[model samples]
Target: MRTLCSSTLIGEALLIMFAGLVAMKLTDVGTGTIWAVSGVAILLCVLLCGAITRPGAVWVGWALQLGVLASGLVLPTMYAFGVVFGALWWCSVHYGRKIDEFKAQRAAAEQAAPAAA
Candidate 1:
């Protein structure tokens, strides 16, 4: 879960930066505002990497995703990017748990084999 979520967040951070640059170039939004928004999004991604094991971190991640989507108000392209990343986030959580489950099962089987031997 941590690995998957962290990887997804790293990707999201990059996308947010890209969107910020685009917004700065194409929109009337102030450079300072773009910088602040991008900075906060990137910072959240870093914090989320460490907080993956913490309670309610997933909710924070979802909020960040919504923030990314909201940026579409400034840069319409971000809506597509946000949706794509959101799906990726979902996949990361879903498949990551499945992988963890498989690993646990394998470990249990190994332990049971040795015990039976």
Candidate 2:
């Protein structure tokens, strides 16, 4: 969970930076304002990486996804990006848990084999 989630978050941080750069060139929004919002969003992405193991962190990730979708009002392209990244986030959490469960079962099986021997 941690590994996949952290990777997704890092990807989001990079994408947010790219979006900020594009917004600066294409929109009337102030540079400081754009960067400030982008900075906070990217910061949250980074911070959430560390919190991925904690309770409610998944909800936070969903909120971030919605925020990205909302950004489409400012930059129309963001709606597509939002959906793509949201799917990635879902896969990370879903398959990551499956992987974790598999690892746990493997470990338990190994332990039981040793005991049986």
Candidate 3:
């Protein structure tokens, strides 16, 4: 579970960094400052999702998704990416918990089997 969270953060950070580079290369307003800000946001996202164990990580992820959605107001072309990320965020929060529950139940059953033997 920890590895999953960390990998997710790393993957998102790489993707966001790539996007920032593309935006800078393609747009007239290629502000290095914007890319720097995004780097910080990506790092924070990594720390929040990977290092934190509380519900705060989930909330922060959702907020980032919302920020992605809001970006459409300024960059309509990127709306699809934001929508997909939001959907992924939703699934991660929803299904990830269910999987965790299943793992706990499986572990409990395994521990009980040895006692029964």
TM-score of each predicted structure versus truth = 0.94, 0.97, 0.80
lDDT of 1 by residue, 8-83 (tens): 9999998888888888889998999999989999999988999987889988988988988888888999899889
Please give the lDDT score for candidate 1: 0.90
RMSD to the hidden true structure, all candidates: 1.1, 0.7, 2.2
Output the number of the lDDT-best candidate: 2
Instruction: List model 2 lDDT by residue over 46-75, tens digit each.
Output: 999999999999999999999998999899
Stretches off by above 4 angstroms in model 2 are none
- Number of the candidate with higher TM-score, 1 or 2: 2
TM-score of 3: 0.80
Ranked candidates (lDDT, high to low): 2, 1, 3
lDDT of 1 at 96: 81
lDDT of each: 0.90, 0.96, 0.70
* lDDT of model 1, residue 7: 98
Q: What's the candidate order when arranged by decreasing TM-score?
A: 2, 1, 3
Residue pairs whose backbone atoms clash in candidate 3: none
**What is the Cα-based TM-score of model 2?**
0.97
Candidate 2 vs candidate 3, TM-score winner: 2
